[model samples]
Target: MTTAHDYAHQNQERFQQQLIDLCRIPSVSTDPERKGETLQAAEWVAADMRKIGLNNVQIMPTPLHPVVYGEWLGAGPNAKTVLVYGHYDVQPAVTSDGWDQDPFEPTVKDGVLYCRGSSDDKGQMFAQLKAFEALLANGKPTVNVKFLIEGEEEIGSPNLGKFVAAHRELLMADVCVISDGSVIALDRPSIGYSTRGLMYLEMEVFGAKQDLHSGAFGGIVHNPAQALAEIIAQLHNPDGSVAVPGFYDHVVALSAAEREELAKSAWTDAEWKEATGVPAFWGEKEYLLHERIGARPTLEINGFVSGFYGAGSKTVLPGKALAKISCRLVANQNADQIFGLVRDHILRLAPPTVRVEVRQLASAGPALMDLNSPYMAAASRAYEKGWGQKPVYERGGGTLPILADFQRELNQIPIMLMGFGLQTDGAHGPNEHFVLEMFKRGIDTAICFFDEVGQIK
Candidate 1:
């Protein structure tokens, strides 16, 4: 009897070519000019879903972009249903962004496929579809499957919350699996069980009513830029921790067992320096690098602009200064509470010389998955079978809004982040690529997960 793995191996060449084709489309969702190309990509996915025998395939419309949805529920209701989620949209790219070749033109070299959307999503999402195809070609899968491939994840998924809320029944399942991130290494797989939340804020400081000559107002009038810099300088203490009071009030402490699991995937200082090109690592001295990144909360000054930064030099004191700030919250901490604390601290730090204004731009709560769930166990077994290695568990430093949104709407389904790409895949950057072998293994892994989940009677 021909097995699904056999079918996957037989169609490897065709699968690679199809991924290349999908990567060719310039579906840069954040770019308004690429709206047509984005729609084209959605249609391509919907058409492929139909060809793969998925029923009720449709291009569901959102306010900005559309979502490509499909399902195969041939397995009876008694069987488990797996909801697969991924984004087809990619970050905007061009040769001017330091690309060696055209960003949209998919190229292959040394067993890696390079293109804008290759690793970010097009390749990962396509792997799920191919897995289903292989399973159906051999025989009926023990579990049902559904796909929710969106087009605006790169832009923070502005409309996805509403879309999911309106289609709760249609998208409900036993568990939701997402393959949109990166693993620790090509050979060493890692499952991300938690992600940090976000609180983005914009701050402005105003001093003089209008621009003034430095020679006249330099000593008498306080410079708004100077005030802004002083205020920002106090946001962090000399120890590099946030100075805001009650900042760590609700942070969850990591258990000794969880710390042991994280140690398995810890990057050496040399490796971190090589990747980040930093002179030295700086964070809370009490916590390890990985813990500071995934377990602890953080306040970062993204960027600040003021005065004259153009050409040579200008002798004018600008009327206002602006700074972009953000905080990464951990589990148990409220986004709103963090924002309020930061805002209040900044106000208190601002000198009476200049008027300060802080605005909340965006916010999202943190998400932690139930690692003990049987669905996660199935994923672990699937990785062992497909990747030839037992996977490690890690907490992601980044934030994915969809995870929290899914938890709230889907009755707390076990959301599995089964990322397939490697950390060095260069996602969202120039020369982004996906290893062809990872794509193949990802298909086999997905197949194994579906079959393994079916046994949960």
Candidate 2:
């Protein structure tokens, strides 16, 4: 009989080609023009599952986009069940958006495969699939594995919560693994126990019914863009903390032990500064870098829109202005409450000349997990076995709403986050790529993770 290592080592070239093939599809969920293309990507995932010897593979439809699911239960009920989550969708990308190569076409240069979705998810997602391929190709897996790959994560997962809530029974598992994020480095594999929540919104400020010539209304009326900027400027303080009332009312203070664990991570402030190419670091001044980023709540303006953004100046007093806003909520914070405080603050700051409207585009609560769970330890062991280093525990500063949803839907099961991508993989950006060396190591990690979980059950 073949071993998982033999299958993985022998099939390295095939797995690389498969991932390159997956990256070739431009499954941009945010673009309406690419709806058919996104569905095509879903079909590709489903077909891959079938070819890998999964059963009951199907493209489950959601109101907005489709989810692809497949399962292998050959290990039977005495063993633990593992569920995996990842997105088949990617952020919108095009050559006009500053790409050195076609955004959809996959190319490898110096051992890096460049393409949108290569690292953010497609590459990481492939890690899970290839694990099953290696395991089952050798023998029946020690744990039953189920895959839930969605196509709407890039657009705030507008329909996934409802889908998971509706199919709780069919999706039940002992543990769930998500590979959408990245470790600090190839050697410093990390696992996260908590994920920040999200609240995204759009605020509109209307000054006049129609645009007026600057010469006619220069001094006579207020500028909507300037007013909007003023409101945004007031959101933070000199210390870089949010100035909005009650913004940090629910923030959970970091425990002393947690602070100690955070100090042990392989990342350093110097490495962070070098990677970002920033002059210096700035955030809530009182907390450490990790504590400030993942353990606290944050508010940011995603984008701003106003008049006269064309080739030159149109010389007009803008009739209206708009700003896209988002907030990262901590464990005890509520997304709705944060949105309310922000909306009310905007209303209070608006002058009588302009009408303010804040529309809540999306929201999801933050999630905290028990880092001491046995399976989490099992995952750490797997990382050590595959990557030849002990893994570190960390909290994710970004929001993966589905992680919160899975806990709410299947509270009895533990969730595992084992990321194989690197921080510099350039996910959600132009010329995105994944390190081929890390890809091979990630497959080995997944193989070890499944084996480790079997012992606990």
Alpha-carbon local distance difference test for all models = 0.91, 0.89
Clashing pairs in 1: none
In model 1, where do residues sit more than 4 Å from their true spots?
95-105, 213-220, 309-318
Q: Write the per-residue lDDT of candidate 2 for residues 106-154, one digit (tens) a residue.
A: 9999999999999989998998899889998986788898999999999
Question: Which residue runs of candidate 2 sit more than 4 Å off their true CA positions?
Answer: 30-37, 92-105, 108-110, 201-240, 266-282, 301-325, 345-357
Candidate 2: residue 243 lDDT (0-100): 89
Point out the worst 10-residue segment of candidate 2 by lDDT: 260-269
Best-fitting candidate, scored by TM-score: 1
With a 3 Å backbone cut-off (N, CA, C), the pairs that clash in candidate 2 are none
TM-score of every model?
Answer: 0.92, 0.82
